[model samples]
Target: MARLTNSMFPSIPSFTDRFFGGNLMDWNNWNFAGIDSTLPAVNVKESDSDFKIEVAAPGLKKSDFKLNYDKGRLTISSEKSDEKSEKNGKEVTRREFSYQSFQRSFTIPDDIVNADKISAKYKDGILHVTLPKREEAKVKTVKEIKVS
Candidate 1:
């Protein structure tokens, strides 16, 4: 016998994966009515002296984001609400409202990071966070001697 599967709704296991396991957004779950939610994707970069985090969140302003740092934990979150209505001289024709919210957290080793100098900024629909490394934690180049 052939097994039949529906594409609209995911299977039981996949439902848990999308709702609980996944840390980033999956477009298949995007919804306007708020039944399903979406999360922005994030990228983390590391260099010899600093670490950078990039968050991709479109259709949002700088005021929509909130960041918090506590006990070596860095948390980033955003919440936004929008309302639109079509009115004809005091009579409303159509109205809609939507709300979005998401949170992400990372644990940073305090010994390697300079928490006091950490900084973040949002530009071009992307959020950039820079974590400066401690002097002792930064990588140092070692000179090599040639053998005769």
Candidate 2:
């Protein structure tokens, strides 16, 4: 029950029950902040010979991504520019797409003898990295000889 003010000749009671009061603003805020983020996926694979890494980033060109290597740290980053133009008195009504960037880095182990020989390629919405292993890392065979 809600108490009414005596200043007015007649007091008006709130139509809502105290136990069932609704705050739509709070609900809206909870939903907005609790929403999950949608980000691209990445895949990595390695063998005794080489390592392969692929990242899924659609609608991005090769020029949008930059790679840098310093002190055994490999960094990959992507950035995009917004598109805004009005030509010949044309009116645009709606815009729904959003553009954001991300960067990732990894520490290359000392066992990787030749980091300069690494290569990368971007095609079909996927970025691929190839890191070849050093010759010393390969397996070898030994023959046994018997002495009489």
Candidate 3:
């Protein structure tokens, strides 16, 4: 049971609770839902030779990305900040500044991955990271012999 301001009445909802959307208890019926998201989407794919990862992040430059591999962990992070100012004859006019950052990490298998050969590149609006597999870990072709 929710604690109400009126001790005499427990069935009625507060003014703010009913005004926002419906009952505060019902989150599903709220006016704004599923609108909170800051992290970019990522896709991972594996093949016989290597693993590929793609991050969907638009409006970011290649220089904004930072990647690190340590102790079987691959960390992908990015931080970008910019400031814009418009001045008119030594007088302050308009200025704006924005900062955005995000980090994502993946656990890599040390025995199968070639850490030194891992590479990444940013193209269009996607960041692609390649994790090459070791020779022993790669899938091998099957051999078959006919029997009479």
Candidate 4:
């Protein structure tokens, strides 16, 4: 699958690829071997006071998440590893190991956001991030000036 550089804009198929009958949405293909190789879905919402980000990641603990904010960018990523072994007569008969990781990033407009006051929480398989807007950036009513 092709990695998307920007979450806001989806990749567009080239004219040649489209004319040649190439799959424009190849990323949606989910085969048995690629079942576990998928990025979690994310939702971003903006309100008058803040912006909220929600990521759907089930079967994961809070410790699995790593969040970073720098240079007007907020990134969320996680990695997990698991190993299992079966023993027979004091000898290892079977062993299995798996590792999974994913990362998502968003560009936050610094003029409207207070990066230091950002907060996050995980609940019911959803990661929520709250980005408080700067006091100066909050919406204000326009005042009409009287003619002199």
Per lDDT, the best of the predicted structures is 3
Candidate 1 matches the true fold with a TM-score of 0.72
Candidate 1: minimum summed lDDT over ten consecutive residues — where? 29-38
- Global CA lDDT computed for model 4: 0.81
Q: Across residues 14-128, which tens digit of lDDT does each residue of candidate 3 receive? A: 5544454346678655433123344778889999999999988889999999999887788999998899999999987999999888898999788889988999999998999
Best by TM-score: 1
Angstrom error of the Cα, residue 125, model 2: value is 0.3
Candidate 1 lDDT, 1-148, residue by residue in tens: 2333446765544443434544345767554233244567888999999999998888888999999987778899999999999999999999999998989898888788898999999999899999999999999999899999
Per-residue lDDT value at 5 in model 4? 43
RMSD of 3: 8.2
Each prediction's Cα lDDT score?
0.81, 0.67, 0.82, 0.81
Enumerate residue pairs that collide in model 4.
none
Model 1 misplaced regions, further than 4 Å:
1-36, 143-148
Query: Which segments of model 4 are wrong by more than 4 Å?
Result: 1-36, 142-148
lDDT, candidate 2, 24-118, per-residue tens: 44653332212222245666787877777787877899998898877667777898867665455576655455567878776767476357778
